[model samples]
Target: MIFYHFGKYILLLKSVFRRPEKASIYKREIFKEMVDIGLGSLGIISIISIFIGAVTTVQTAFQLVSDLIPKSIIGSITRDSTILELSPTICSLVLAGKIGSSIASQIGTMRVTEQIDALEIMGINAPGYLILPKLLAGVMMIPLLVIIAIFLSITGGYFAGVASGAVTAAEYIQGLTTDFIPFTVTVAMVKAVIFAFIITTVSSYQGFYTDGGALEVGQSSTKAVVISCISILVADYIIAQLLL
Candidate 1:
């Protein structure tokens, strides 16, 4: 059974990658879904990013100030970590909890209702039609969202620094820029793309294989999000170790 499931998983992956970049047939429909995924999910990303930044700042500041480590290094450490690792990775987690589940649920529902089968009957490739736009949208939008996440996180760090009396605004800004390397942002964007692919692919796969009725769909959706989240967190560590 395990081998059989693995075989199915492999085939599913092949199906997705083999046609991931095909000219989309349902362009309008896919674009609408992309808009929903990218634009509609923006608010949650912003909130989570800022809040994480603030909390990270508070923790880092306390440790630095407590140890009497030169508060000079605080901004560099904070910004570098946030840009290269925390923002993109953490925001993906947030989206996994929020948007990932929604995608899984929506796709699962369609599957359970036989909508996908109907598409197949009409000579459409259900997998390609349903999953490609979402996949592409994930690729396109996550980097942009990661930028927002990093920015918000930095802004939160600034406020947190001021509130905690860690460093003056000028000093904090100066330190942040002193070691600011652009490669960190590139790493972040790369992470975001990986995360996007992970979330979309896992969620779509979960939803696609859903059988039975409403309860099964619900179960599939839950599993999709959980799997997506775990995969991303694990992948984040691996990617960070490799990149940073």
Candidate 2:
């Protein structure tokens, strides 16, 4: 069954990547999806990022109880942690729940309502028309969101470290600025893109193959979120191992 679903998912991806019937329409749809996936997700990302960073900073400071250790190390730990793992991974997981479920439900509804059938009747490339824009948008916007999340998380760490008496402002700033690796950012971006692709394509696959009616649609949505999250975690570990 797993092999069957995997084969079907691969076939669906091929269909999704096929040439679109109209470039202009696809472009318009792409922009709409970008806004929906990016802008719509900003609020929750912001909240989650800030708190995570703050907590990481506090916890890291708590653990480094040695008087011999510099307080600035807290900032370095928080910065690296956020960039390498927290921002991209956590934010992607949250988005898997938000955007994945929405995509599944939307496509599942269309499938059940015969809208997808109607598209076929009209000679449209239904998968290309329905899923391609989402794929493109996810590829583009998710990285941008990760960037924002990284920045916000660091900022939050700074404030929390200072306010909580965990680290001084000057020490935190020095730590954040010092010994930073450019490659970490590259790895994060790579993870962001891969996670984005996983979320959009997996959700769309679940939705496109949805069977039955309302109850089934709900099931598909739930499955999409669960699968997307699992895929994100697996991809995260693989990327980390390969890159770092």
Q: Mind giving the per-residue lDDT tens digits that candidate 2 earns over 151-183?
A: 999999999999999999999999999999999
RMSD of each: 2.2, 0.5
- The lDDT per prediction is 0.81, 0.96
Residue pairs with backbone atoms closer than 3 Å in model 1 (clashes): none
TM-score of each: 0.91, 0.99
Per-residue alpha-carbon lDDT of candidate 1 for residues 139-188, written as tens digits (9 for 90 to 100): 88878888988888889888888888877788778878896788888889
- Give the Å shift of residue 112 in candidate 2: 0.5
Scanning candidate 2 in windows of ten residues, the lowest lDDT window is: 70-79
Q: Relative to the unseen true structure, what is the C-alpha lDDT of residue 213 in candidate 1, on a scale of 0 to 100?
A: 89
